[model samples]
Target: MNSIGRAPNDQTADGGLLGLSQRLPPSNAAAEQALLGALLANNKAYERVAEFLIPEHFIDPIHGRIFQAIVRRIEAGQLADAITLRGEFEHSGLLDEVGGTAYLAQLLTAMVGIINAGEYGRAIHDAWIRRQLIDVGETVVNNAFGRDPELDGTKQIEAAEETLFKLATEKGQDGGFVTFERALTDAISVAEKAFHRTGAVSGLTTGLRDLDKKTGGLHPSDLLILAGRPAMGKTALATKIAFGAARSLLVQGRETGTMPRGSVAFFSLEMSAEQLATRLLSEESRVSGERIRRGEIGQKEFDRFVQVSRELQALPLHIDDTPAISLSAMRTRCRRLARTKGLSLVVVDYLQLMRPAVGTKPDNRVLEISMITQGLKAIAKELDVPVLALSQLSRQVESREDKRPQLSDLRESGSIEQDADAVMFVYRDEYYLQQRMPKDTMFDSADKFHVAMEAWQHKMELAHNKAELLLEKQRHGPTGKIDLFFEGEFTRFADLDTVHGV
Candidate 1:
């Protein structure tokens, strides 16, 4: 055994790890100086420097995780230990990837040693962590700006636009001077306006009348969370937006001029893409679609399915029916899509069903959710596209007479409300009232039964296909709601204004 590789002792030169301590960063002041330099020069390079500065101890990846996690936790005003970390990693499904528990202990030992070395140690840690976050934030901001660092804000947008306009309109003429700042602001504004136009359906729109008037579109890089209690039409309303956006190009003239760059990536942790497609098909076919779900469709129904399938095959929508996805995996996939296909929009059919990757147990459900939402915000920024994630309300919502969800109702964790750029909830008063009779009317007890019958016969005749999209939140715009037509047969949502709401 000693013949092949260097003996285990060969890897350690000066008496195992004890020989290596002197080489550790700042072993005193020197280590602090080196770390400060790394943090100042490159914010993201700390992880590398962390390993480089103390390879003897952080040689293992788990140790790095532990070291980073503990330092971050300490910074956040929390205590850390194997018990807490083990629970966190297990809950977050990260234990195996975390390697072993002892590594975390070693990592913490290193953090405490480094952090307590003096105020300088703490300062270095803070600078390093600041750099890490700024690195992350830069990635986020760049994504939000869509590959244009110059697109910093409205001012940058205007500046860039002016530059382009000058180049086009001025041609060879030296059109005075369009300051770089002014041109950059103009360009950014142009990029923003272009992004906004994608979400605006020219034909039939369902966003709140008031809100729509203010925002024009949901805006790109917006992490929109649509949450509600079970059966609250969360999916129904989101689908309305999806269908509305897609059809705007189909029935209307929006997508006619330019070839599509990327359509939509609708990630369904709960529903299958085929199932969503079937719903849409039924809505378009104007035939009872539930029969197909039950596999009781006769020849005529099968014919309708065929027609619907033919129509949907051409839409620029892609669906992934993956269950229990990791945030990192989603980011990788979305980034690839954006790079290759120019992804336009990302939709997650509900968030709670997703799971963190295995190997690391999260300390608490709240932290796990925080990580997920934060990851999603990153993805939204990176892809420079809107991320529409569906969510569920807590059981507390059911306890209240008003089942309509507020930010507090975001199930699993409040971190969702904090992380999302925009939060929306879908509610249907009519759906809620099916259990209670109208107070003004004389109808009693059997009112729901009668209403169900009427919905099936009378309304179903004209439009059993009706739904309401309650826009409960819009971070930068108005908060209200809207109504739409829900076609059960086609699983398609239409502007109720086309039939009734107007």
Candidate 2:
């Protein structure tokens, strides 16, 4: 393995200076032989390790072939004893390559019993994992030594992280079918939690009353799309949800003493971390972010901002404001946060700005968006956290008479609708109506202008401080519009006053 990507030295032909034995990667040859023997001795023993062990897990190539033959025969509804495999190998003219029929008998001698097959298989797999780790280390070293000039220092680090994440999560056999009884147990557990919890929410509560009642809650392993046209307050709503979830997590932790606020990862592609922080502060303090930025706020408002900022200093919300962050890098960062701090939710501020995994480039924008959404869903499932990704609606929404975004308005990508567990649109009728306000200069008469102005004012009054969250496509629940209170000045969203009417 160490000699893999480079030319062999002069001593390589004669077993190398390091010697063939020393150069070999970590492997348990006896364990491999024992596992194969157990499989050949009792075909039922294969089930003990079938979930994790494969043919390549064997140290010896001959053993791999024998294991493969056994698997094929067993899967074909035929007995896979040593004699049957030998006959199959003989007919295939590959008996000699596997040390003829003698090796089969030797493997039987190597086996102590079929009862230990699972243990032996695990040993072999552990050795293979170690070998893979060594290979990854070598690649990292080789790349660090300038093996790939195109990859800069940071890109190399990201690439290494990507490789390690894949290895850690997807390598070997970590997933398989679950028994029906066990699955039922898990389902019952979820139901029990829902019964005990407020509003029957078995998942993370988003802290929005109507939204929680409508959708239950932000569920784990769910990829939710929060999309809208420009000026629709998508970012504001996403931030609100993140803040709510973080607060809920913190309160729960304090009550149970189990955690310190479930961590939230906000990947802000368009805005810097400070900018996002300011937006949150503006929402909390009821001071306009623009006013704060322009130094237009009074001393009282500024003091309120400072106090709110200090109070929010302990929220487990982390922001990664790297623009055009690739999916691999995002996954790596999220994994790091999950490992160190414990992640509960992820928010990507607009997915269109995100790039796919490094080294992958789609030929068209649509495909790229598809890849990004799929990656987001994958991350949601991998991390067992809800991912709230903001997206841009297509320009076609502007041409519509109602101006309320539908599922088709999700930009150019159909995959966003397809991949998302829930697709929500942030639509503010006030935003569109403000654009249609009649100007006196465009009117021919004062009476006409007054009529237009009055009509516009009536519409504005109705839509003022109101935002509709259109839950268009919910895989597990109903779809409808939920009105929320939106303050454009502070860019904040909250539950509407249902008792007083929205």
Candidate 3:
């Protein structure tokens, strides 16, 4: 009888059960044994896979225990060999359970060579990944079979995605240290690109010249927060940046005579795709969105809008207007887009409207926001792309005398500020000024009302079509306010023409 108490004929040569669908969880007992043997033979071999391989990656329970003992001894700066491991196991009263000292001697004999330890470790890790995939598949099947009634179809999908993401993150061996010389070479390459590139921007351009100048453009693996009060053009600013990135990709593709290697993904949770498209049309065609919706445009304006839409159709931009999208689903979609179209940038309409991963239920809204922000930052780093997330400020900003937003005004400021590489506030003085227009009833005399009205009108003129982008926090650069031109009718944001005195 074999380990399962079945007839020897029921077992396959590779240790898998036969006549039971001929299937067994993926594993590599031989590889696990060889790796453990290599470590026991030469303690130095432990360093080869120390970064990624763990005891849990081994298939054989005894092999995993032996490997873990070796790891502990080696990490503690103590010599680890077959003799030392046997002593440790014996001391713990598990020597017989692990096949005794005879098994330790057998493992040492199994070692092919110390040089092959890394390969053996990788084989064991790969088998472990396959095993985890099987488990995930089983879970998904069980959930579908009504194992969890609370998980509807959509929730189940999200849960599956989250599980896969977690598995990939935990088991993937993509992170390691880079030599300083290599890092310096990359730095110089970036500098060279910036030196030759127009505007000397080293990263993806934000479409606004001043913003690009201040930030050197949006960088890869960066999480930038664009926050503002309601009607402060947060979405409009984020859309402008997305459009700019898409246009840059298109221009680069044209220069190379090939499709852009990557595209922009905009997740608009607050607005429908059509509404966002209309706003883009308004910005480019200089037609009011309200007028476009109401069919108030002339034939010429309609023709302009159609032409703009045709041009924009070729831009490498994708929009998903999934209302209140879960973070896991968003990550899954981004990964899919990256695989198919090559994702360069991700823009979320607003983080506050997003829900955390499907299965997680945070105790409070603050924790929920923290999870979302951290997840976004993780996505940016994992995908090596910039994530521009729009955010809403707390009402405290409105209650202040100076309505300009600050870092403290960020809703759930702690996590948002900590996770973000940059935090910017979109403040339109015109919007606030419009709300405080002088009223005749507030003044006692006509002259006083007229004087006040004149002053208010003057302030309005100064702030008309103007906006301020306050860079409250920047991890890599200076923090200051950037002036922008905001046309409410078109819902557009552009570089303020300070020299031209617009």
Candidate 4:
């Protein structure tokens, strides 16, 4: 250890850890081996492994927090300098020891570096597997999985797994993953994995057939943007997806295991959770969305509402309807929900509505939008879950000859386009129908004048319950369009093939 390092304990002679090993690096080769032995002998983080060592690790708890802060800043694409690290510790009230602020800077300057996620991923896997092999009483490469020669393949596979794990335990893994020469190799592997189950599938599968077919599912660590202008059904689509994912996860998550249902956290920057729930209820119960808003339900309708509400009740769907939520505040809430209720999916209703950090608002709208989108992306990766955010399209879409949205139609399109793993646009042509009459005897059957002339005026009819789901960009799969049935009264989006016209 260094002259400034904490003194080592005398327990090393009795097969116990010298506390210095956890915080201070040994001064020489002999001391390094002894420190490694101390960690290997007494550490409980690894079950069966003698020791786990990384080339870059925390010297102490203070250093660990500083490292974590740097990692977070790096992931967010912000520079993590000494000043930033000190400020973080000071804010958290974590840097009271090691002679206060000046020492904090010194420690950080000495002990901060980046950790490659993929590289560390391999190391973690190795440490875990080595522990498993030793504790499970399995000989490393010495025994077969079974006596039968047919089991030889299984044993070989296990050996391969163990070998990979061993590589991870080392400070470095020598390029363990496959890098394909052709782009089609990526496609082929995805196809293979999709058709043949990769152990178990994670995440909720939205009932949208084409969406599920193309994207497989809304994957973890993804930022999926659903963009459309007002009255273009952006919020409705977002709410629909959130409802489906949360319900599905609650229905089929880890069946016969500890976590049978993974609850969803819906961070609504616009509507209240109750409002969202009512929308879901109206959709599920076939009640008119307007009627639900008007509270015009009869006893029978109320009964049906009560019944369907019960069905949706146990499905672990949580909603936090905080208007104008800051990104960090949203993150804190989501993490809390994840800790307490096992959160699986997050939904931010309309990204444009979000506020930037307290003191760091940009001067221009484009810059502000960019900051919000990037923050959402970071939150998605950090939480290891899918973040579905609703956005607004630019006015140019309506002005163009083609009403369908292009990449440029995305409001603050660049950053939103870059950060998003998938960008879906919702469009309704009938909403902008150019005063053309239907082809029924060249006369409009329904009109304001016609309604006035009729003696009975209780006329209400649903038009085509359909909308097109245009996949503008899909990072992992094919980008195309799919149509879905939209019930105006019920506020439900269903498969277009099953649509019934009125």
TM-scores for the candidates = 0.54, 0.75, 0.73, 0.60
The whole-model lDDT of each prediction reads 0.58, 0.88, 0.89, 0.64
- Tens digits of lDDT, candidate 4, 1-502: 4434545444455677554324433222222222322222222212222223332333344433544555566546565655565577678787674245676444433321222222332344444444444433344333464544443554455444444433433433333554554457865765576666432233356756656766787787899998886777777777788777876676565465455446777777788888888888988888876887788989899899999999887777888888998776676677667656776788888788898754476988899898889988887876678899898888877687768788888745548998899999887665554233334354456574454434222221222455788898988779988878777677678767744432
Candidate 4 to truth, TM: 0.60
Could you give candidate 3's per-residue lDDT for residues 279-364 as a string of tens digits?
99999999999999999999999999999999999999999999999998898898778767998999999898999987899999
Q: Return whichever of 2 and 3 wins on TM-score.
A: 2
Order by lDDT, highest first: 3, 2, 4, 1
Candidate 1 residue lDDT tens string, 67-154: 4554554445555456666787888888778765664444333342332333434444444444434444455556466776544565
Q: lDDT for model 1, please.
A: 0.58
TM-score of 3: 0.73
- Residue range 1-502, candidate 2, lDDT tens digits: 4554333242565663533334557789999888888888899999998777788777778888888889888877999987988899899999999998888899999988999999998998888888888778788878989998877788888777766776666665456797888899998997898899988988888878899988888988999999988889999899999999898888888898776746989999998999999999999999999999999989899899999999898888999999998998898899878867988999999899999988887999999999999999999998889999999988898787888988877747858999999999988999888889999999999999999999999999999999999999999999999999999889999999979976
**Best prediction by lDDT:** 3
Q: All predictions: root-mean-square deviation over Cα? A: 19.6, 6.1, 6.6, 18.5
Can you list the residue pairs that collide in candidate 2?
none
Candidate 1 differs from the real structure by a C-alpha RMSD in angstroms, to one decimal, of 19.6
The CA lDDT at 453 in model 4 is 38
Which scores better on lDDT, 3 or 4? Answer: 3
Clashing pairs in 4: 1-27, 465-486
